[model samples]
Target: MASATNTKIVSSPLLVLLLFSLYTSSAEETGTTLTSSTEEKNVFVLDNYGARGDGEHDDTQALAKAWNAACSSSRPASSLLVPKGNTYLLKPVTLSGPCKSSITFNVKGTLLAPPSRSDWTQDTIRHWIMFQGVSDLTVTGGGTVDGNGEIWWKNSCKTNEALPCTEAPTALTFHQCDNLKVDNLRILNSQQIHLSVEDCANVRVSRLSITAPGTSPNTDGIHVTRSTDVQVRDCAIKTGDDCLSIEDGTRNLHVTKVVCGPGHGISIGSLGDDDSRAEVSGVTIDSVQLYGTTNGARIKTWQGGSGYAKDIVFQNIVMDNVQNPIIIDQSYCDSAKPCEDQESSAVEISNIVFKNIRGTTASKDAIKLSCSQNAPCSDIALENIELKLEGGDGDPESTCQNAKWRKSGNVVPSPCKGSN
Candidate 1:
């Protein structure tokens, strides 16, 4: 409707029921289901930009000649302005739609993205803004898309500082798009992945404000790889590493009331060790809020991994100064030692659930289940989970576990007995 806020990717429940029935149906039924009959497509106008987007120069060919004259406007168009205080130094200009053809980008100006590479290519597609195979696309207002990335996060490690050394790429990607809608943009400083939903479908990302620096290593604040039926709601992520990472061919996802912090909190699979791809099923991360984080809710599966991380759910999350508030690492290794999996498709972290979570762990283990004694972790659930670690009486050579930690009528969380 007229209040669909800003977006990043995945949203199209028939374009939110045709913009809420065309904003309460009037004005001749919102001009018979809008698609721009000048209903609103106000393209760049900050005195035709001489300098203002504050990223300086290369005004991206004058905002890609005003977005190719407003998505080739020939009457029927509906929303594409960026007018606030004006700081529009754009480059990658693409807005494809013909299917249901519903576009909206009010975004009160400050839409910047010009770090070069010929201002982000088109046919070869390098990112900044791209949505091919679009359907009812949306990117709402209260603008800002500053991807000036301080020269790629100060050379994001030229020699491998934990993998994510992008020179300039991925700042808002919507690959293989459909029914997508990215909302309420603020999305700042990006060298790599600040919002990405690949191979999307019926997606929705709402009330967003995805940021960068925390040292800006991989950026990564909302990265759903090989996607399908996604939803990330009420967001406000602080980056520099995994603040919501669902990878390895993801499936029907949902992450709600998010407010992640300082990075690395809400993850599911580093998954890539030849991450077999396809089979990360029905997922959910609810009511999240983590500050000074470092793995508050994680499910990392890998050791030379394959597929199947099914039916996951992490409920009502809240952790402060976390260091591993609640974890499930299926022998995930990064080569300093444990790397030997000749053949083991073992990813099955099944029917997982963690409801009513409450936390405060500072340097490790409030709960850690390092599965895979030979692929052992199935039907896990922990309702009413509470965590409290960060003091001296907790790490007596820690290595917590719960082999069959099920709870609902009996409760059990103590049988991991392997310490360092």
Candidate 2:
């Protein structure tokens, strides 16, 4: 489970009635029914509420006020317009709702974050902008959200250990939301992760461009946890960490038509951390392009952790100069301190399929399955895979330890000899 953040939930019955009256009056005057004109007159403009989009003033309060007005409006649907051609400077804020109606947050301008690390304190929430408990929400606009994360990136332990390590804020976070649609947004240079969807269901994300420097610490492009029926398509992501990460409790996730590079490739797990239970199932990745990544496709779990990962598929992938093109490491450890050698991981992995994967690997060991001895990986299948080292003379090799798999049709470098 992820850490909880403070949310400010507000509603006003009198305000709702007033807005409803105003909406109805406007619709009647315009000779349109309330059903057809609900979205037209229900726009709450931030500029009218004293939001000067000059990129210098803090507009957090102004945005919050606009959110409250829209959320409390009694219309069937309301729009919160962030108009184009201006830059709105903002601080950490949460827009929470068990709203009376659905909302559309139309972002058409730039939202800029503080430039200096000293501007943010540790007690601040780990998110710059958070949407919580909202259903039927659509956040779509051709705009940019700039985190200005250079200072935070410099202070990170991944860059320099002389500075004290602290948590940086995610650029955008959606928590406990359902029926969400996010499209055509550019999220760039976040202090931590770019976009996070946690405990959300029935989500569709597309046409998003998420980018950060390859050396940035912990800057995953999209991280989903405890979510279901999530579909991410037509996204171009370049980040330091995994382009897409599926954490525990996520199911029925489909990712397709993605272009990823200069990052750690798509991954599942590094789960079972601190002896915790982690489970993820029913994930599919198809038609992805990975270039110059640390790892192409991977599943990693730590020792002394219990749970199961099953029914996963990776097909129709194209890798270009990637390291560890295909891998599963049961003894996955990311900390600087050495981990104690354990006999096995308690997590069970089964029913994984990798098919039609064509790639060029930078490492000689292009395919590696290092599973736990006690709980070996079972029911794994590989088909039509062709991986070769980029500039090496020798053929790429497959390394397997306590992994059982079946192969069919055109496998390159051949399967390991000790398969059961």
Question: Which 10-residue window in model 1 sums to the lowest lDDT?
Answer: 1-10
Candidate 1 lDDT tens digits, 1-420: 111112122232234334433432321111122233333544334334343456565565555554445555565544555566667666665555453336565666576776655555445334676666566667766567877776666665633467553345777787777777887667887767777888888889877777787777667888888888898887777887887788888888988877778888788877746554436889988767788777888888775565678788887676766887678887677554567764355666778887766656786446777777656677877666556565645641225443565655211133244531
Local distance difference test scores for all models: 0.66, 0.84
Going through the candidates in the order shown, the clash numbers are 22, 0
Top candidate (TM-score):
2
For candidate 1, what is the lDDT?
0.66
Off by over 4 Å in 1: 1-69, 73-79, 85-106, 109-184, 187-196, 200-223, 227-242, 250-259, 262-264, 269-294, 300-320, 323-326, 329-367, 373-397, 400-420
On residues 264-298, what C-alpha lDDT tens digit does candidate 2 reach at each position? 99999878888889989999998787889999989
> lDDT winner among the candidates?
2
